[model samples]
Target: MTRFGSRIFWCFVTAAMIFSVISAAFPTKAEAITFTPNFTISSEAAVMINLDKDVTVYEKNPNKKMYPASLTKIMTALIVLDNVEDLDNTVYEAPLVVFDELYGQGASSVGIERGEEVTVTDLMYSLLLKSACESAGILAYHVGGESISNFVDMMNEKAKEIGCTGTHFVNPHGLYDPDQYTNAADMALIAQYAVENYPKFVEIATATEYDMQPTNYHEAGWAHIYHTNSMLNRSSSYYYQYAKGIKTGTLDESGRNLITMGSRDGNNYLLVTMGSPMYDADGNAVYLHYEDHKNLYEWAFENFEYKQLLQAGIEITELQVKFGESSDFVRLVTADNYSCMWLSTVDTNRLKETINVDPSLLNDDGTVTAPVAKGQKFGTYTLTLSGEEICTVDLVAQDDVTLSALAYNFDKAKQFTSSIWFKAALIITAVLVILYIIIVAASKKKRKKYRRVKKRRKF
Candidate 1:
């Protein structure tokens, strides 16, 4: 072959190799369509979170405060689990005062009478399975050292400890009180804490029914206390196979509320719905909470899948550097891999990424100091869909950047020379020099005139 032909062949071969490498590193991402649940959300506040991935997929007024109703029992149960050491063996006696207060307020009851003795296990089942407000009172009264008020205080403290900002409890039973309220987001946090910390809570809340056997409070064991959440009952029309144990709440003032967990095909989620319509337009009972939770779960399961939206050590953006060893730009990347359950139909590119560089990262001149470590976190970037936030990832240095001593010293010297104090000193020194020169010139002129006058006199 001719030399010219050989050169062309080699150039084409090299170009092909480079293109292949670039293509492999960044394979083309297939576009996906964004999906929103087609069904209407009747509840005023609702939020659904993926437990395994730790991300929220759906939210409507998640942080708005609303009545939690019996959902407050989840926190009440959490406090009980923490205080009570034995669930079955530690028996408590129902106080006459507790009975009086519950009856006076018309709170739900598990048929406990004054001076009745019951085990902690029985009370836990009653609180969770039976929605037994009286059981809540008994446990609180006992655990709180014969003071229901003190137990309510503990509940508020626990809610704060669990990172619930919008939750405040004036009573343990979750009956309507103007001051006692929580938002869907806050309720989700409380529920997640209970499910993760107390397995016993889940076991009881998930039960279809519990047999309240013969105790001093009850002569007949046939008083079957059933779970208030219909999702757990197989015979109920709202029964969902993926649904598991949690809690529910209802009140004329608060409407209907529900906190439910669903796990299907290894994906687990918690959904909280509050302030749904209690009655249909015709004034009959409405169960929109159940319908809303079930439909949202199915929609999420069908449309969502875990996707790796960001990779570690990949340069996301660059920031100005003042004392860099070689270049004036420092590249930043996320320290850890970022992945979330995203709508399967939505294009990954549609996910909005917003970079928030630290305001302090740059000086007035808009440059950061050098010597940045390989994995130092500089700031963070948040991922969102439409307006809803998914997660925040720490933006870190992609590679180590050594400080240049010479450049740093030079910059400091420049800064010092340009300072106001230095300029003021320089101006004063210049004025002094000018004054000294003028004084010396005046003295010389006077001496010269004196010499001239003396010479004229001699002549």
Candidate 2:
């Protein structure tokens, strides 16, 4: 072949290779879709979190302060679950068990009279399902200590331990205490821990009906009992299918409060709503707590779909070393797979990836030494969508790049190739040049493909 022809042929081949590299490095932009969840509640704050991805799917004033009401029972339940070994231990409900201020109150009750004996299991049911103020008092007084104040302190300490920064427990039962408060986000986090960590707690909280059998003190046991979280039994309720165990609260000051969990197809969500009005116009009552939860769940299911954009441990690029043992380059890989939510017909072309590393990483002689261990982090590869940073992964050494002592020294000893290290660095730098060429070629091909597809459609 003629000299000019050979040069042109090599140039064409190089250009094609560069184009492929660029195309692979930069992906098209992913579309951004707006998520609108329909929710109506007078609640002061609420949040919905997707357990699997650990992302908030919906939130409204999630950080606002609201009286937790009986939802405080959730923290109580968590503390008990953490400390108690015997779920069926027995206890007596004496006059001492009743709070002087709460006994005559119209709040939900376990119907425990003075001198009533019951099991710890029964107290839990009453405290959680019935939101019985008396039951909570009994548990607090007995489990925490003789002093109810001490128990209240324990509750406060537990609240802090479980990461409820916004929560303060002045009492066990979530009766509205001016000092008692918790935010929706903190409650959701607490509820998530309960469902995810304590299996027994989850079972008890979700129970729709319980048989309150009589103990030695009360001859006839209460036959069929209902749950305080009314959403569990309401068949027409959208939350019924996904609703797990949690507590509900209602007070004139705090309004209707709920901390609920819902699981669908193995994906769980922690839903919390506080300060919702239970009564609507005309004095009719509604379960707006569950309504808010349903909207958040529906929004997550409708809008979020996960897709993998890059495979984990795939060699993305290679960098040559100026003063390495071998003239070859080192391969770079992604630390993990890229899985993200994106809209349909998203323009992936706008997706951008950049590799970053320390300038001094190359040897003083300007080359990289081999024997790089697998999983060793060299730099970071960041992927951005629409100029918004989304995923950043470490650029790891795909395999060991070991340099022979002779190769290192010869390149070092000889001033040949502008300091063997620099020469080696220049080689790695060559990879970046190759990347640039690939990107340009890939752009042309993509443009050509789009044009051809468009022209064909016209035909």
What is the Å distance of residue 108 in model 1 from its true position?
2.3
**What shift in Å separates residue 339 of candidate 1 from its native position after superposition?**
1.6
Assess candidate 2 and give its lDDT.
Answer: 0.71
lDDT of 2 by residue, 1-459 (tens): 234444544453443332110111222223322233544655778877767776665678878888888988877777777667787866646456455758566767877776777877888888788888887887777777666778888888877777877888888888778899889888888888788788888888888878876787666656457787766776554436667667888988988888777766666677788888878887997767677666666666565666677778988777665434444577889877777654334565767888776445655664455655567666777777666676777777777666566764554334434545445545655666677778889999999999999999999
After superposition, candidate 1 runs with Cα above 4 Å error: 1-36, 217-220, 315-336, 351-459
Alpha carbon deviation, residue 2, candidate 1 (Å): 67
Q: Write the per-residue lDDT of candidate 1 for residues 1-459, one digit (tens) a residue.
A: 234444554454443333110101111122222345878999999988889977777889988979888888888898899998888889888888777776667677778888888888888898988788889899999899889999999999998899988889998889889999989999988888887888888888878788875677577674788888898888999988898878888899889998889998889998999999999989999898888988999998888898888777777898887778977778988766767677777776777888877766566786667777777777787777787666677887777778897987666566656766556556655666667678889989999999999999999
Clashing pairs in 1: 32-347, 33-345, 33-346
TM-score of 2: 0.70
Off by over 4 Å in 2: 1-43, 52-61, 82-84, 103-105, 221-223, 235-239, 277-286, 302-309, 317-320, 338-354, 362-376, 384-390, 399-459
